[model samples]
Target: MGPLLLVVVVFLGFSVPPYLTFDPSLSRLPPPPGNHVYYPLLVAHVLFGTVAMVTACFQIWPAFRNNHRRGHRLTGRIYVFAGVLPAGLLGLYIGWHTAAGPSVRVANLVGSALWLVVTAIGLRAARQRRYGDHRRWMTRSFALTMSIVLSRVVNTVAMIVLMPQVDTTFLGSAELMRYSAASIGPWLSPLLLLLLADWLLERRKPGAARPA
Candidate 1:
């Protein structure tokens, strides 16, 4: 688990810089058809998402949460307010503007919505001193935040596995099939990941002790 987290952290750490600079060489497309606004928003999303992602790592570490409660709380504030909030909002806009297809766009909306709602719930829980709920909500939130990475991985694998199975002759365009595969991955991966996470958590949690 630690190793996996480290890898994700590193991936996100590296991913944010290209967007920060807005280099066309690293861009997915050419500014989305004349919309100057899109570029800045994409950059903002990456920046905020990066902050949230980095801070979320420390926030979730049991050692930091348990031993350095003060630091945890401080980091939580930044994660929620500075990291997830604006990033999630901007992400929705980007998702809407994304060119692939409705599936990709819808996936973005759902992912961004989950990220925002869960984080908001976590922040509220913390304010009320319901630390347990806060932790749970934040866990869910962080999962969606990391879904960006998961989406890419899933997209790549799906493109590899499913693209070949797609009969482009009947389907009209192979490009559309490719887009579908990519979109399917991003849309499906988050729900699958969230369910798996919940299942593992439930299994790991101790059942109520029998009355002695």
Candidate 2:
């Protein structure tokens, strides 16, 4: 997990009250397919994803695991079964009503799917005693999870810092920015982070904790 991303997700997860409440206006979510189910589902997604991130962050720390093996297993169980599984599935459901449109929907759907698959692989590897593989795949899983934070980073850059003043084309100004975030940015995020993880791992010696 990225330090900045861990901090951002942890803080945002706690700070956003309207997200966890019945009121969806302060939630800033797009209108769901039906009025009845969207808000509750969104709240569940937020809560589960936040808890998952917290557990995942703790899992990455060698000191925590070294000291508390049972706690590590407990957190891993929460991260996978309770936190990521339902949250990822709910994210796919919520993708239909995303403000960023189809590209974002596709991105999120694919990302969540991969997050589940990768994390499952990690969990399986651990079960089989492949600790290094578990470490690697979990890193990939959390990298995808961190896409939420990077979405804002990309949106800030593409929409505010890099937006052209005199550009009017097929896509509107809003479309350009939001699409850049939802579609384009996240596709590149996990790949880049995974590569960085690999490089950092190489720098550590022949055998280490696999860079988490």
Candidate 3:
């Protein structure tokens, strides 16, 4: 498998099983108190998000797309409809209802919204036979899709850096430090990844010199 696919698979392996158990105790973040629908929405989001991640590998695999055009198209459709669409919508609901605090809510809201919009535009470009545009947009979409992985990394670093300052900066509230770290992950990861994607896309343009 390509490195990207391998990374995604490893991420899924580590992250998805707990949710599959349908046990609230296994959730990475606790559901909001008295929010009857929160757990269910989170589960649905995870299931569909898994679909998106898996199918996205096939959609981006050059060998598969080049050698098996029909399969590529099929997987692309699955990625859009069955994967991102439901996942993105469910994520919005979950984000809105999360107990993680304001920064996290904003991050989730913006990230989910951007994922949906970028993917939809990519699909539209593909339908219009604007392959270049389609590719660029989908690159951004994929970056957003994989931002979850980067978010984890960012969260870890943020937590480590913030931990030392908890007493002074966070007023000795460990919970506040944790929430602050959590807040950085969702938005910062996607923002950085999207910028990277844009840079890569620009370099691939016609007449641009290939990277050494």
TM-scores, in order shown?
Answer: 0.89, 0.83, 0.96
lDDT of 2 by residue, 1-212 (tens): 36665676666755467785667677767566567788888889988888787787778788888899999999999999998999999988887667777877777788788888988999999999999888888877777766676665665665564456325542457556556645666566666776776666666646655435
TM-score of 2: 0.83
Q: State the lDDT at 195 in candidate 2.
A: 76
Instruction: State the lDDT of candidate 1 residue by residue for 1-212, as single tens digits.
Output: 58857877788776766776777568664467878898888888888888888898889788988999999989988998899999999988998998888888888888888889888998999899997787777888878877777778888887787666667532656787777777877777788778876765666566934447
Model 1 alpha-carbon drift over 4 Å, by segment: 166-172, 204-212
Q: Is candidate 1 or candidate 3 better by lDDT?
A: 3
What ranking of all candidate models by lDDT puts the best one first?
A: 3, 1, 2
**Weakest lDDT window of 10 consecutive positions for candidate 2:** 162-171
Local distance difference test, per candidate?
0.80, 0.75, 0.92
**Candidate 2 displacement at residue 41 in angstroms:** 0.8
- Arrange candidates by TM-score, highest first: which order? 3, 1, 2
Candidate 3 error regions (>4 Å): 210-212
Error of 2 at 186 (Å): 2.8
Per-candidate alpha-carbon RMSD to the true structure: 2.9, 3.8, 1.3
lDDT of 3: 0.92
lDDT of 2 at 58: 79
